[model samples]
Target: MLYFDESGYTGPDLINSKQPYFSLASIRMTDEEIAQIKEEVGYCEWGRELHFKSMYKSYHGQKILDKIFNHPLMDNYHVLPSFAHKRYCIYANIVNILVETMYHFNGINLYEGAKNLILANGLHCFAILHSNKDLVAEFENNFVGMVRKPSIESVANFYRTTDKLRYDVDTREGFFDMLSEIPPTIQYIKEALTHKKFYIDLTIPLFSVSIQEWYNKTKVKENVLFDSSEPFFANIEFMESLRDMEVPETVVGYGKGKHVYPLPVGNMEIAKSHEEFGIQLADVFASALCFALTPRNDKFVKYQDKIKSLPIFQNIKLNIAPSTNDFIEARMKETAEIDPLDFLCEHSDRININKKSNI
Candidate 1:
């Protein structure tokens, strides 16, 4: 079974500047494998008696860290400060390692190598679970004999009600708290009981890491206008494009104005202008993707510098232009006069224009 998800987000941080990290995590495992992992972790045996907090102290102490650090898998991946800063890096590194461990056990990575394995084996009716509806649609469009199911409710409920005893202390309590509140999706391989033969593939993460490294190392330049704020909010034209493409399934959960939760194409609910949302999204994506590739938690500024050095990151940034002050002011005015929904629905093609006639 393939369970895919992205993490490190709680709510849209349009106005707030405190939270620093956002990420995505995907896990692929069979029912039996999940059970076996749970057993190995003593989660099944301990039941609710052991909470994540206590479990971390009891099971994954300094001794466990030593073992993991010395393990062969640690050769390429470093455990020290996952990122640049000391505090944030530590937390980020721990989460990265945990996700890495899960992927190692299941032989899957971010680049969809596991799915390739399933496809190569003539596997059909593969279940794909993800929180992002757009991602689900993308997968469905690309793959034949694939089934998509929304599991946000199930995953959220599990995190909410499950006794903390089942998890480790170092686990972000806020993550569990948020998961308990939001809906999550889960995917799996169908008819695995009948066809037990399967091969586990483990090259995707390396591929992603390598690609990221390559991107970071490469350099290119282009002439581009600055539209800083557009990347944060969902552009009306972009949303229309997706809809015209017959991709409305990507719109899941209640969005603010025309802006959706998981995808770009909606407005920033709290911000005075759509441009702000674009900036925020750009920052979030840059931070998350960098964290994913680097496996080290660095501050946003430092990460930005590192990303600037990468070819792919440079390409992405080059595409992002800063919003002009005139655009910002006009958006603020528009937002003040209209209800978000009405504005989103009615002003589809309208870009805010300043009365001053400044470009």
Candidate 2:
């Protein structure tokens, strides 16, 4: 069976300054192993639900985290984690477009304009620029040079250092930095447009696809148990959709030639708390992942180093697809040479925000 939980979900305000990650994690186990987990939790005196966020700061939480992270059985189970960072989304598409627009207009780099504005006011600068059509008009009027110049370095540098963009010349060094940051950030943005079903709707197929593949190898049909915090519609609709419809062949990575199984959630169950040992452990695992990926909020800033070093965090697997938006994908393809998975792994240990302190 599969037990799962969600973390860092903030609806459509996904790019919010403090919390900018949305992750869904699932842990697959057999019925026999789940019984063992219940026995383990009972030994720890965790008679009721073991909420990861609640237990996280307590002595009990750390002990549990250590237990699950090192468990030989758990190490064997498949842990599927799918997540995305919003700021990187902004950088890969939103900022890239603006940089390309500003770079070639009579040599009056709009990237300089974007940098100066963003440094002073953060990403909200985009709203100001978007609102001010007059700025674009003024630049166009003064243009004395050619348009449509392809300057990938200028765009990468704008994303790399907002402050330095004003004083420093564009260099090849920032190109590597920008490519290193895009992989974990490159999923389809459409998945984030809604708040009600943010976690389940977006991640169900991803989890199911992986689970099906595992079943093919082991000949075990895994059922799913989700923490009850998920919206009722998500629980009901996801199960119904999986049974009634074909998993949409979209950017969600139902890649061709791979054995596609109809993963109905007929066996899916939802519980209100960590009362179920499987759900509880899923909570712990999901929360740990969310903490590692999300931007630092006030509550977590103090524990940054400790959180990163947690054993559960050591070997995380992330799958993020490029934005489905054509414009963004075109720019992303032209701007970076490195692979997305490598880039995300390199930056996985800490938040990728430049203005923030490194964790």
Candidate 3:
């Protein structure tokens, strides 16, 4: 099985200064294969669905996350003032729970030192990014007999490689559009994948949970560590715990857009459009997970919390569900309506009521 994923380090510039790396991680395994592996590890089925709607209900009751929103601590902080902030907070927390649950069930902590275990069991892990060479190489050196492949780019262009293959995969336009809005430092991620040598035999699906869903699942309290910030930092912490694991053939994929990459745990399909190009469900799941777990700094952690506390963040959610296309359309509309003559007016408000909305 192949695991791939992507991650995003999104927050105000202030927070990003501390922790700058954002990533995702995904893993792939067949039901039969995972069952055999789980049996060996003394694990069992905990749930059925991976979607937030199903997972939330299975883990906690509806509106269970209201507690987080109603917390007095939330009111003290101005960062997460609206329901949207509450929603984002909940989504991050739910992901943390799922990852932690998986770790405990597997009798392995990807963060605590799973790499050594993986290597002992014969697994290969490879990361594609020019920037992570030092970290990747460090792991390669520690885990003997483990193969590490290096690609000289931040992003891997699986689209170009799999263009010939046919599969029933979701469109990537939303993802790509999200990537375009990021700063130059992040923009290179897409450019890096344009080169072909980095291609791998995998596909990854990245999707974000809706704000309402995020809020519903996150409100519940669990006897788990809560980071009170972007969950990626915690995810990286978990991955770091497995730095010593040796596993055969590990692949990581990053989503270059707005989609919150999907998490895969149960039944899914793997198919090909043509023999030359096709993808398996496992490949996509792995990639998405890897990306989500990428790390950033303390600055990002603080900024994320602050963003979550802001009233504007909440209004943004109600005004328009947060999305790449919605943001772009809104910006384009504003740009088109700007008037030089009105710039000097003290209270000039421009409104284009007839523009097409494409969110």
Candidate 4:
């Protein structure tokens, strides 16, 4: 069983400046294993539930965290986490909402041959390089508005900003075809706006990514627990549906990142963190990793020192926010490395995008 907990959850407001990243961590252990870990870290001495922030504050607390993060059981292969940069979540959403809608309208399989990843990363790298914050902010705000209420104004604004962005950069490398169909896609969004099923909160998609990661690692139905302290009220129903659902191979193929089981999931529940030692450790990992990724935080350095180099075999760290060009380049390179032939053949249209330019 794996106990899951998260840090930096601001509902669907992914662009909230106060918390730019969300981290979800899970540790797999049996009851006996949890007891062993608690004993190893002297968790019972606290006489209360182990909370990460309070424990991370004091010198003694830091020592305890050091012991917990470095415990023999929490080895490199055991640490599993899913980290999402909120802004990047929106970036990917912009592509998925607009471009994926376009593809669906045209009866094309965006997910086939991993084209979704290629286009999302391609659009993101190009937008950050060529588009200014105001332009991007307009696009992002319109997206949030459209999802929340689906206003005609929001769609119009989004369409205008998207239209400008598409032409701003040369489209030879990127999928301009997706952009060309924006009008029809906007019409689709307008019609579907009233359907609650169509407008998923930002948290749902990123949370889905994490759930898939968990199932991918375990590949079996297992008990997954979440810290009830942070209310992901939106996640509960979606999670329940995942366990009960199944799909045909044509709809979703089985593979490393794809769903192996029809609808990969097991039993998932919510529990108080204080009552669950495994959940508490997940809290530690989520908070520490979230803080460590934020450059301005002083604990960023100290926290990274304590948590770095841990064995993390299954993870999702979506750091697509604009930090450096190298960050974008490195991730794109990883996509290519995953399936060089598929990437080469499928992304032939994007060959020029692989090159760097002033635009």
| CA lDDT of every candidate | 0.27, 0.47, 0.25, 0.62
Query: Per-prediction RMSD in angstroms?
Result: 24.6, 14.9, 25.2, 10.0
Residue 50 shift from truth in candidate 4, angstroms? 2.2
lDDT of 2 by residue, 6-97 (tens): 77655434335566566667777777887786666453576556666777677776677566666666653456655655443444333333
Model 4 TM-score, 2 decimals? 0.76
Worst 10 residues of 3 by lDDT: 198-207
TM-score of 1: 0.22
User: In lDDT terms, how accurate is model 4?
Assistant: 0.62
Better of 2 and 3 by lDDT: 2
lDDT accuracy of residue 144 in candidate 1: 15
lDDT string for model 3 (279-349, tens) is: 11122222222222234354335433533453323432321112344444443333212222122111112
What's model 2's TM-score? Answer: 0.52
Which runs in model 3 stand beyond 4 Å of their true positions? 1-68, 71-162, 165-326, 329-359
- Could you estimate the TM-score for every candidate? 0.22, 0.52, 0.19, 0.76
Of candidates 4 and 2, the better by TM-score:
4
lDDT of 1 by residue, 289-340 (tens): 4343334344445533443453333323111112245533443333222232
Considering lDDT, which of the candidate structures 1 and 2 is the better prediction for this target?
2
